[model samples]
Target: MSAPSRPADWDPRASQVLADPIAAYDHMRRTCPVAHSDYLHHSVFRHADVMGIVLDHHTYGNAASRHLSVPNGMDPPEHTAWRRMIEPYFDGARVAAFAPACREIAAALVGALPQQAPVELMSALAHPFAVQVQCAFMGWPQALHQPLLQWVQARNAATLSADPRALAAVATGFDSTIRHLLQERRDAGNAAPDDITTALLRETIHGRPLAEEEIVSILRNWTVGELGSIASSVGIIAWYLAAHPALQSRLRRKPTLLRAANDEILRIHAPLTCNRRVPTRDVTLGGRHIAAGERLTLVWAAANRDEAVFGDPDECRLDRDPALNLLYGAGIHACPGAALARLELEAVIAALLAATASIEPAGSRPTPAVYPAGGHRQVELLLRPAAGS
Candidate 1:
C-alpha cells in the first residue's frame, strides 16, 4: 500500500491550479484526499466528500466568520434568520425587472466599444457590467466602481500573497465603500427604482428593520457575488468562445443554450476555487478522518471534474445538463441572485454575437491570465469584426 500522506501547510497547486486547474484536480483527487489547503487550510478534493460536507449542515457549519463571508459564513438558525431578512430583496420579481436594465447596460457597454481593433472585453465589457449592476442595486456612487473592482480582485488574489495584508487592504476598502453606501441608502430612505437597495432599507427582520451593519454585510455579499464571481465567469466565456469558433457558432444558433453555457463556464474555472469550512466535530469523509477545527477546502474545481459525478469531466459540452454543475453551489448557500447573473451574461453574450460576426485575439487587450489567487485576467480581443457586421 502507498504511504500515508502528511498534512500539508498550504496547497502547492494554489497558483497553477488557478491558471489551469482541471489538471491539478485530477492529481489532488487521487493523492491528497485531505491535506492542508494552499492557504494553510485543510482541503477536501473528492466529489462524495465535498457533497457530504456541503449537504451535512450539522457537522460542517457555515457560521465560521462574517469577515470571511457574511452570508456564506452564517450557520443554521442565524443563517436562515439573516437569509429570511434578505430574501425578499432578492426575489424573482426584482431580478426580472432588472433584466431590461441589465440588457440595456450590456448593449450600451458593448455599443460604446470602438470599432478599433484589439479591445479588451473585460475592461470595456464585463468589469463595467458587474460594477454598474452591483452599485446601481446598492444605490452606491458610480465613482466607487473602479475601487470595488480592485477590492474584489484582491479578495481573489489573497492566497497568492505571502501575508494576508493584501486581503486586509481589500476588505478595508470594501468596508469603507459599504459604509458610505449603507449610510446613503439610509438617508435616501432605502428607496431606489425597483432595486435591492430600496428593499433592504424598507424590510423588517423578524420584528425590526435590518441594522446598518446588516445592510453593509448584504452589500458586501453583493460585491463579491457580482464583481468577483460574475466578472471572472464573463472572461471565461469569452476565452472559451474565442478559442472555439464552432462553440461560438453553436451558441449563436442555439441562444437558449446560454444558460447551459453559463453553467459550463462556472464549472470549468469557478472564481471561488475552494470555500473554507471548519468541522463542528470529528467525522470521516472519503474514508479519511477529519478532526474538528481542521480547515478544509471544499474544492469546487475538483468536484466539478469528479469522474464519479460527471462522467467525462474534462470535456466541455454545451448541451450538458445545467442541474449537474456545482458552480452556483448547493443547499441553502446557493447563490440567490443566480437568475439575475444568468440574465446579464446571456444578454451580454447574445448581444456580442448579434453585434459581431467574428472576433479574434489582439494586442493591448488584457491577456486572460489566471494567477493562483485572482481569477480571470481580462485580455484584449483584436477582431476584424464578423464579415458583414
Candidate 2:
C-alpha cells in the first residue's frame, strides 16, 4: 500500500470534478500539474510528464492491478511477448476485412434511428452499435449482447463505488461467461466457428497454448475497450458535431476528413480518462517527491490538452502534429485495438453523417458522465434524414 507522502493536492471525487471533469482537469493542470489524491493517488496532468512516463516503461511499470490484465498490466519481456502475439490480431488486413461488417452494423443502426425527433443518441445509437459490433467481431451469439452490456454497466458502477466485493463479483461473472464460451469451442473441436475468440484459443506463447486465465484476461480487456471506450467515443463525436454546426457541415462536405476529424474531436474530449502506472524507483516529478512503488495516474484527458503541448487545448486543429496527440496513447502499452477502433468510429460517424441531413442538439442539456466513464451519459440529438433517402 502506497500512502500519500504529504497533504493532498486535490479531491478527484469532488462534486465539481464529477460535474464537469474536463473543466476540473483543466483547472488542475494549470494549478497543480501533479496532484495527490486519495482516490487517484498521484495524478500527472502535463503532457511532457505523461509522455516521459509512458516512454520509460522500465522506470514507470504498468503492473498496477492485482488481477491478471495480460498485456495491459504487464512490463517488458513479459509484455513484449504478449504484445507480439496480440499485434497480429489487430493487423491491417484483419481490420480491413472487418471494415465492411463494421460499416454494415453502423448503417443498419443509423437507418433505425428516428429522423427529426429527440433521440437519446447514447442509448439509441452509441451503446447498441458498440455491443453489436463487438459481438459480431468476436463471433459471440446475439443473445450475449444484452448480458454483456449489463455486465459492462455493472463493472463501471462497481469501479465508481470502489467496492472490492462488488468488483470481484462482476469480474468473476465476466470470467465465467468467457469460460463458458471457451468451453463450448473446446467441446466442438474443429466445428467451432472461425472467429477472434476461437483463434485466441489456438494461440500459443513460448510454444505452449495460452492459459485459460490469460485468454479471459485478454478478452476482458478487449470487452471494456469496446463496450466502454468505443461507445463513449461515439457519443462524444456526435455531441461535438451537433454542438458545432460549422464543423459538422465541414465534415459532411468532405467525408475524407472524418478519420482525422474523429481523432481530433476525441482528443478534445477524451473518451477514456486515465491509465495507471507505478514507479519502479524513487523519482521527482512536477517538483514533487514521489517515492518508489507509489501509484501514478496519467490523466490522458488533461495531458492531451496541456497548453504546453497543444496551444489553446480546446481548439481542434486538424493540422496539429499527430504524434503529439495521445488519443490512442503512445509507447509500449499503447492501445493494441487502435486500428479496429479507428475503423469502427470512422464507419459509424460516416454512416451517421450520410444518413442524416443534420444533427442538432435537443433542448435539454447534455449530462456529463462521472469518473470511471467519459463523454456524456445522456446526449439528446435531433438527427434529420437526408432529402432523398
Which candidate comes out best when scored by TM-score?
2
- Per-residue error for 342 in candidate 2, Å, reads 0.4
Model 1 lDDT on a 0 to 1 scale: 0.71
Question: What is the TM-score of each predicted model, taking all chains together?
Answer: 0.87, 0.97
Tens-place lDDT per residue, model 2, 35-112, is 998789999999999999999999999999988899999998999999999999899999999999999999999999
State the lDDT of candidate 1 residue by residue for 245-347, as single tens digits: 8888888788888778767866766656767677999987766777787766788877877877777775677776666677777778877777777887888
Q: List the RMSD of every prediction in angstroms.
A: 4.0, 1.6
Steric overlap count per candidate = 17, 0
Quote the lDDT for 333 in model 1: 81
